[model samples]
Target chain A: MTMKIDCPFAAKILTVFIKEELAKFGFKKGVLGLSGGLDSTVCAFLAARALGPKNVLGLIMPYGTSFGEDVRDAIGAARLLKIRHKTIDVAPMVDAYFKKYPTENRVLRGNKIARERMSILYDFSGREKALILGTSNKTELLIGYGTIHGDLASAINPMGDLYKTQVRQMARYLEVPAKIQKKLPTAGLWTGQTDEGEIGMTYAELDEILFHLVDERESKEELLARGFPRAKIEKIMSKIKSSEFKRQLPPIAKISSRTIGHDFLYPYDWEK
Target chain B: MKIALAQISPHLGNIQRNFELHLQAIEKARREKAGLLVFPELSLTGYLLKDLVETAALDPDKSPMFKEFKALSRDISLVLGFVEEKSQEKGLFYNSAAFLDKGKVLHIHRKVFLPTSGMFDEGRFFAPGRNFRTFSTPHGKMGLLICRDFLHYAAGYLLFAGGSEIIIVASAAPGRGLAGKNGFATSRMWELMGEAISRFSSAFVIYCNRAGLEDGIVFAGGSFIFNPFGKRLVQAPYFKNDFLVQEVDPAEIRRARKNWPFKRDDKPEVILEALKRIVHDYED
Candidate 1:
């Protein structure tokens, strides 16, 4: 039983990881933005177990014209868990910005919504002094599907590594509402938008490709030979290569004698 | 309960070796029947790495090193440190601690206080955590404080307010004094910090510090356990890898708090006013 667990699926051990993490940081509760999608729902379930039902707060931030069922499913999951939850209608705030700047694209507006939701989550986190748990999955992180400084922000992330397929499995294990578990994955950025549709590839295929590419370190030609579409493999590889910057901190120039991103390589507790 | 202070000397960029050492410590802890086991700061990746962007990066979900640590969770309730790759966000590296039990990670605490002082540039490598709180576990209400975080009065006060019975300080304290000189200054500072912990929070404190050297900076491994009364219960060997075990009683915390009564008699507003003045002087 004293075997060493690999670090990648460390997020899978959420039951123990979240609790110990919270205790270590002195956090008794957690707040997260619930989008009624697989990622957020799984995060909510994990946070509830980590901090308890009373300690986990779910804030549903819905922009204008959200699918009604998605909101209901999110609320339903919270109710099922008996966790405290609230709804923050972001339609008015998002609409106001769009009205003022009519030329803004929906993508720009969606990014605003994401940032606004994060802002609210952080505000509540401050008031409650609760940690803001993140919900983005590994697939999103690898493919750069998340909005930078928006849905991508959190005090700590528990699901950064579970692929989209793995997230669905975790949702099932956590007994998430079927409505949420079965719903099409979407960022709710616009009407009739689905994650797969936008990405132009199914998660099963994406995960398979990514597993070969990242975990197996397969070459592009090998991935194509392994039944991955040439165009899709190229696209996913491009994302993984390009979004490496997004995965890291802002580059610090070697101005100081010991630069952080460069020379200074101590643990967060180095000064203790 | 026997508590094992697993003062592991981590490799700066070797996840596999560090994780193997962690597993070895857990086995030792179990054999000793220790109820809790603790590891040093960033035990997964060594401190003072040349490029954390490259050295400290870990995909806990996919990294083999993380998987090894997770499997080790079944036997002992272990605490260890590592770097976690955050989501695809700008500036999202995390200094993380994982709580492991029963073959799983019970919880994780990201480092909140990023040091930006001399020879330290954490603010540039990781995002600063904003929340200060406590966590509940089978062990009890516990608080996790990283290095430099215990120096912050607010973090300590918040831990007390959140009901932390035991405060664990996992650190890599820099050793002062020359190669041939005694580390008197570092030891004195650690003693002062222990006294502060006993006076301010009145909780049983366990400090686990890394031993050995990294990037020319020698870690003064002055790890120790402090009673609620500010008494040193056990002190590990300094400047070397060592482990010490001490039994902690919850009732002793109550006794110490009752004896001190600092928690009940303090004026928070007065303390805040003084702290604010130290940071900035505002005109009335």
Candidate 2:
């Protein structure tokens, strides 16, 4: 299945979306964490175009286990856009906390690193008087591959709706650094940690199944008939089901008639 | 006569702010010497009003806000969308569009189709309108269809049967489906419908869609005008606030109607009879 999008059209619309949405909330500047991965690099390109290079800031937050090449690529992306950037080694803060509470689990340590980066991003956001722009694409968001309150937290996200494969298309159109585009997708949480490696499928296969399942609303049986592996379908479906909570606000128990997440419904852009 | 489509963003659930936007647009249209100014669906209250419908609902005849608009209409005719509160019942409301001309409410069209599926929950909030009718304007006989009402072919057909020469649609359609190189898939669908309706009905079709984002739903602001012969007169830019004013000669309506003669050959009695049979069969 060819899940192609008009790259130029998407780029124009996303740029406008970022600019207008930020202005709606009285923000003229934005700051986003740059992982040197395709997602953040694409976001950096869009943010630069939307808010101008001087107004946008990219933060490269990496732990001790992070690759030196990834850090360099992050700086390269920022320089390519001519935007201001800062590299903060998250090892000191993350290590300081884990020193008292030592754990052999890499996932736990990675989650801590993600949260530490978010904390630093917020600090920079306040210091620079800028809103934090999110970089999670539709694939990561749908499959629950992100850490909530960590990478998932941002005032606005222009690339969240675009799937991973679509982001690649956008990157090519935006002329993002070829090295970043060609590099294997990773969270850069620990050494040699790749997204597709952990997910156990290439982005092409995952996005095709996800597009059918989510966007086109194709059933599992229909996907099977269309030559999709049933096991992959089941695995993706289960992941989606399990990660549903990550997509929404915490359920507020209805103790009153007008609950925050229930009856008392207000839009996010509601200035009043 | 010149018709102005105000493709603007309405502040969500903020009547005062949106009303200010309307006044500004009205001033601009008047300065441009437009005979009529049309705003998008819920121009006073914005779309995605889940629980704020009642808060924004107003009785057109009783509200002080309309009085101001009515006074403004004395200078230029206006068409605007708002949640209409039924005077008799306190809670019953309709997604309605009003035509104000010469300081009076000429016609109010409560939206007949309340789309309540897949990212839309209009039926959950408001009552559906029952009739599709046309009202006389100084320029021509015009009909109003709000957003989803324009989607159903029957609404335009009914208005066409009612001797409408101009079909005005106020929409807050969300932008989606980015596979096409031209623009949004949703905007393309609206244009296709507008072309078909204008050609078959032999009436001018003016589509006014809102712009800007509300809770991530971007209202595709590709507002446009189709002449009586299905030729596009003008179109606004997508996803941006724009004011489009075009001079539409009333003579064009007559020429197109005479050339096509679709209305002269139309038979509504046949359609009414067929609808009755279809309804009976479906109920059975």
Candidate 3:
């Protein structure tokens, strides 16, 4: 039940959305953390097409335990897109932070690594006068698979509405390298950390069911009647329901008659 | 029934320049051998006109540009959005759309809903219109809506009740909510509207939306056409100036209506009585 995404239409609007959104903030250039994954590669292609390769800056940050193949793929993506890119090793920073707060907690280490990469991307954003473009897809954002204030942090995100399956289609349409497109999806937070292994669901299955549940607004019984796995439907539905807060601006205390994020919620680009 | 949607980025307060753009688009559509061509709301005067609306109004009857449009319609029928200057009364205007063919205005629809809340200030710029009528065209019996009018269900219902075989909406919608790589959430919302009316009423639907940035607000320009079965026949590119030409079959409408006699079995008098009763009891 994989959805057939309209690739040409999606590509056109996304490229325009990226370029126009950037211009609204007076940014002619953009920055992104290229993980050599399908999502990042697709985003890099769109950004390059929108703002031209010279205006896009790709940062490839690999941890000490990251596979060398991932590094090669990231560099390959940058070269193919012909964007200004730099590879910065996050090993020293991740190691230094772990030394002070040593722990075997996988979640904490992953969070730290994500935040460190985010911090570096933001630094480059300021130095380069470029906005930070994001690579989080709809599935990851809906399920809270991304770390908050880490890789999820961005000035503007163009791919957030697309499902993982849709992302792959767009990547192939953008002509991303075969290595990046065929590679197993991973956050590279730790060695051998695959996204499907962590989420315990294939994107095609998740997207199909979610398309019905979210897009078609099908009820639980309706989904089960449609032949979706009961347990998988429950898992995906609960993840989306609980991660709602992450998709919104932080709640504000309503002491005044008008609150920035509440009563007086203005658009983010209102400043521009 | 070949229809063409010319999605152009109109310069604010420049009706002359926009008219020239329309001429170019009309020529392109003519070259494509299209039967009908449509443009977005205020395609002549760009959106967000607070102080410029007064100077932007064009008299559809007297304006020589409309004669040009009428002459062009001899080759290809045209639906265009412009600020219509109220002829009988000076200093009054309406956000209007004109249907032109064979050297005359076939119909003119002023926007019924003047959106005032949020970023829209149409109420401050022009007066709201009152009628929703369907008129004959070279292609089919067509109804016209200007932007916000299509957002209301009654607009479509009234047009359908008047025997509109096709509904054309000219919109100047700004893009918002970039939830994912899919572009504007605005697009999905509009698609839902177009799909429902096309299927339920067994009528063709043409939604022409503008593109490009307007004073920091980017117009999500995904102009598209849907057949009576709610199938998207053609789609224009979003966020850029573009056009699409597709041959529509009025027979699809006839087939859909014959299959589902919803239009045939409709009870318009009941709706009128209900609305009258509601209006009588309304306190607000």
Candidate 4:
């Protein structure tokens, strides 16, 4: 089953929300890693809309194993958004560390590539004076599907609240390139690697279950009664409960009266 | 009804920028699970826009800015101040407050008692509103009073008579007088009135005011929410922009009214006939 969203309504709020949040922090320009995937495409379009096309810069940092069509689609998205974009092949940077200290595990190598791409993106942020906009959707963030300090490291993320399915819906509303929107979801970690093939379930199924469990706060029995299979329910619940650490700030042992992340909470624009 | 009061500074004559500010506040409120959000007077356009009124006048149903607002109201209700253009008439506008919910305009209150004295020259730019009535919302019956109108006790009386259980005040009041230990004199006075109204009418009061400088006038930022018993549930900081989300129970209205019996003993028809006879028989 497919999901539905009030596209125009959601788009208006999100664009303005992004624009105002950035302005409150005194930022006029934005930079982000755009991989031509649905998540990054949606983020790029929203960033362009918020800061204007000229103020937004898209950085396409592709690994050596990244599909050629994916890189082409990233270029197409940049043209469509009319934002200044650059293609920086991260193959050399990622390969440098791996060649010096070889790793046999495919997942370890993939994590290295992801973190290297993030490192390069940060360098550009300092050089260009732009905030790094994150592209990880709620689905990936909840399940720890992406590298921790890699794709998840962002100054601000407009897509953090949206589930993967909603990201696709937003892409359609933003009139993203049809080819990119229609393509299979991927992390581009390996050749022909798809997101659905990786996480062992479709985003539609995962998000629907999560919507009920997280948003609705449904009990396990209630979810099973709602026709969610027990195995799938247990699997998703385990993932949600296990990845709690990744989603949270590094916990500080209670030694002081008020610690940084514990009691001393303030808005991000506290000084402003 | 869970409510959020957004004490924001709006750019003068820049409806697009101001509209985005309103959206940002609304979206934040919705995330905090607030059912209703309120903004200060002329939130989409800052106050003291004497000549720029024509450019800022929005036909509630026509303006693209308002269209976006309606779309947002599908999930949460909002109260905001804007220049309302009468559809049938040109060049006639009112300093209006709107109650928007579920993609529809639930009610609108045109500021009736336009303050023309002292620093307030609202009557110079806006036509006076004639009637005060309460309208129904998804939460309950509600009324709207903008800025100076909230000060007039008669406004609350009329709203209570019209069955309003929640009174929303949206203001762009300038912060004035010596600062009290807690807040400004203007804000303290408003809080006193809010408490009095809550106890007298047995209704909740949601007050929203703007922050930041508009021209030379510094709009006060002491936005607050009071329960039916006049207890200050939440308050934003003074002289700076702030947003607060607080939970309010609609059930409290019934409990407070049951204890007070004010609405039950109220006489709307007698007051109406007496006022009518006074106007007809007496010379002012």
Candidate 5:
């Protein structure tokens, strides 16, 4: 007898929720930063379906020395889906920042690039009166693989749960370009940088362990017994713990009868 | 028109449990003869489930919960939140809301604004929705806004421009009051939103919020209704399960809009001045 594994059809289900939520908000258009990666590609496909191609705006912001093929693939995917799209090169803006600051460190340069990209997305969202759709997946969010207030920012997200591997699976289902589907995951921060290569573990393994530790509440000893490297576990666990601040709103100091972060308890729709 | 605000709790990762709660609310609304019933944002699946939310999300077309909701739409119109599948493509999901009446889904709104800052990562698990239009119900033409959408003036303005007589906001706003210092500011933010809605459109506004704790983040249940003149008509208790039912007259909305004429006074200079204030450029 074979036992069936339950697959999260999360993307499909979230599409409906997003539609209804948008209706509730009285918004007619959605905008997203399409980075030609597995996450953004998946998000774009979902947004296109949820809001219709006419109402979805996909902005592709590429910095200097981006993988040319990947950008082309992003354009191709948008065309295939017939979603509204535009490409804005951030090389000039990024170069200006560096020229003004004169930073040679790749990490600093990468951080500036991420933040610049976010600023552009938010600015465009205002101009279009559209919501900014986020593209970070659960693996990145859990490990804080994203920059604070940068790629980690958006008005709403639809793929925070799927791991990199799961995002790849969904990408295939969405018919994303093969180049994007096969490309090694990267923040495109600098030349020749890949997420797994930098993190020292593949998403498949990381997601498996993270699920066990966070969702299943497995202990470190149990994880070690199950063949997870103790060092890797420690590193990942520490990252999750340290990054908890990033996952929360700014700490508020309560001083009133009904404070929001402290005593005020209500749903998003409590005023009806 | 009497509207019922359903500030009920939703079970985490449990679609069936939430659907039952919604059904119960519908029954209560019908018994009360409420013309409209509202629920909180993402009420079908408790907010901030992290990755668990994705696994538990349900497709609107195929979900039994959606079917039950449609069936419940006989005597009253209802608004509720759920995870829905995008019809045009595969593997796409949205944070969606549905307007159900007379056993049909009249309209569906996907959340266009996803909050990804600080404690919210809506941009992580849901896609943004598009299309701004008000729905015409027996009670009146009404507009809807979700949690973060109300923070932006453009969303409310669009609804007013679309001729909405009333605007309803559904939210699962995390309890800032639980935070020792910032609670008052958050509360003030909600109050300001109420004032903005009335001032901008001179239309009645209703906010329905959820209550309870999920994943240690408590919801601040300050659900309330504002008359067309921006006066508080009814307010619900915070941090607990509660409901409010109030009657609204369409004539009040017309009278308020006619009297204020704020939309007419909304010129480019006025907009520029407002933008300056929003950007904190008080020197101008």
Candidate 6:
């Protein structure tokens, strides 16, 4: 079952959220890592709409093994939105580090690239006096598909609650370039790496299962009865269980009566 | 009498700023020549305040703020929400709404139904109130219900039976779901309840909801006024602050009560006896 969202309504709420939340944090400008993927492109559109094109900046960071098409698309997305953008090749830093700590693992290389890109975005955020807008959708967040403290790091996320399929719908509504919207989602850590190829399932299938399991709170038995493969359901559940740490602040040992995350609970917007 | 609904965005845990905001709203309402101005739930302190509730709680009798509000009430009546500290019972707090009229604190209604399920933790913090009393005002007998209190049918029914002609609900309901055209699903839910209660009880229903984002939860600000016949008079837009004033004629209440007679035919004694037996049986 496709979960349909009212894109225009969602866009209105998200743009307002971006503008107001940023203003509350004493920020009128926003900076984001534009990967030319659906999620990042959608966020760029929202940021431009919220903070105005001049106030928004997109950083297109690429590694040596990154696809040329991906780089062009990122630049194209920024141009379409009429937001200021800069391209910084991160091959030297990532390659130099990997030379000393040599590894054939693709996941390790991808994690480093993700972290490197985020670091550049943060640096630009500080230099430009702007907040870093997040790009991770709910599907990647729940499945632990992205690197922690890497793509997951952001000041605020407008699209965090939206699923991947919903993000695609938003992309269409925002009139994001058809090339960027139709292209397979990739982190661009290396050539021929796609989110669906690595995850071994289409976003539609995963979103349906996740919508039922997470949003609807369907039990395993109920899922099986609804014609979902038991192995796939179990795999999704385990992924969610394992990725719980990425979604939360690191736990602190409770020594005092009032602990930060435990007894001493306060909203993040407190006193702001 | 003209009633003004002040849809405001309170700074979280910043009582001084929220106080200033309230003063501004009071000034605007007075300028608009409204007889009474109603604000959303916890207009003095923002919602989603987990640990700050204790810090924000104030004794209405001792606090100078209430004194100021009382002095301001000399010009126009006021109704607003705050975290009420029980002076006699230390460390206990109640999510309370106070009705100020003629330079005096007339009535205070602590929220009876503290929603503690599914993203809400009100029951964990606030002690549930035990009464649903109505107080007399210049317009008519009025009752105050917090956000969750209005959702309960019995709460509105009890107020209707207690001779209430106007039911004012101050709410901080977060926007949820996007299946509706006008506003969020949660917002639509409140409007339906407001319409139903106004029609059933033959009372004017005035709902004031807050605006702005607090910890990712956006308070839906579709504040509305419904006449005794359940016809919507005016509505503020969603997700934005607005000060809406609408003339509320008390004669509409008489006309509606005459047409429906829900109030005249209401049998509170039967309900009381049934509840007494049911509670005794359940406990036994």
Best by DockQ: 6
Task: State the lDDT of candidate 5 residue by residue for A1-272, as single tens digits.
Answer: 11111123334344654554455456768888877778888888888888899898888888855667667877887898899999988999989877888978998888888899899988988898887878888888999988889899987677776667667767777777787788788898887999999999988788888878875679999999989999999999998988877677898888777777664544442211
What are the lDDT scores of the predictions, listed in order?
A: 0.75, 0.91, 0.86, 0.84, 0.77, 0.91
Residue B247's C-alpha lDDT in candidate 4?
88
Report the Cα lDDT for candidate 2: 0.91
DockQ of 3: 0.05
Point out the higher-scoring one by DockQ: 1 or 6: 6
Residue B163 in candidate 6 has what lDDT? 96
DockQ of 1: 0.04
Off by over 4 Å in 2: none
Which window of ten consecutive residues has the lowest lDDT sum in model 4 chain A? A263-272
Error of 2 at B34 (Å): 1.5
lDDT value for model 4: 0.84
**Pairs of residues clashing in candidate 3:** A159-B181, A160-B180, A160-B181, A161-B179, A161-B180, A161-B181
Q: Is the docking of candidate 1 incorrect, acceptable, medium or high quality?
A: incorrect
Worst 10 residues of 1 chain B by lDDT: B176-185
Interface RMSD per candidate (angstroms): 15.7, 2.2, 8.5, 19.9, 18.3, 2.2
lDDT of 1 by residue, A117-154 (tens): 99999999999988888888888999999889899998
TM-score of 4: 0.56
Candidates arranged by lDDT, highest first: 2, 6, 3, 4, 5, 1
- The residue-by-residue lDDT of candidate 4 on B1-284, one tens digit each, is 57999999887777888888998998899899899999999898778777678788999988887788999999999999999997887888899999999999889899998999876878878898888989999899999999889899899888888898999999998865331344455777788888888778889999999987543355668888888877888888776789988888989999999888999999989999999998899866
Q: How many Å off is the CA of B62 in candidate 4?
A: 46
- Report the CAPRI category for model 5: incorrect
Docking class of 3: incorrect
Instruction: Give the docking tier of candidate 6.
Output: medium
**TM-score for each prediction?**
0.52, 0.97, 0.66, 0.56, 0.52, 0.98
| lDDT value for model 1 | 0.75
Each model's DockQ score: 0.04, 0.58, 0.05, 0.01, 0.01, 0.65
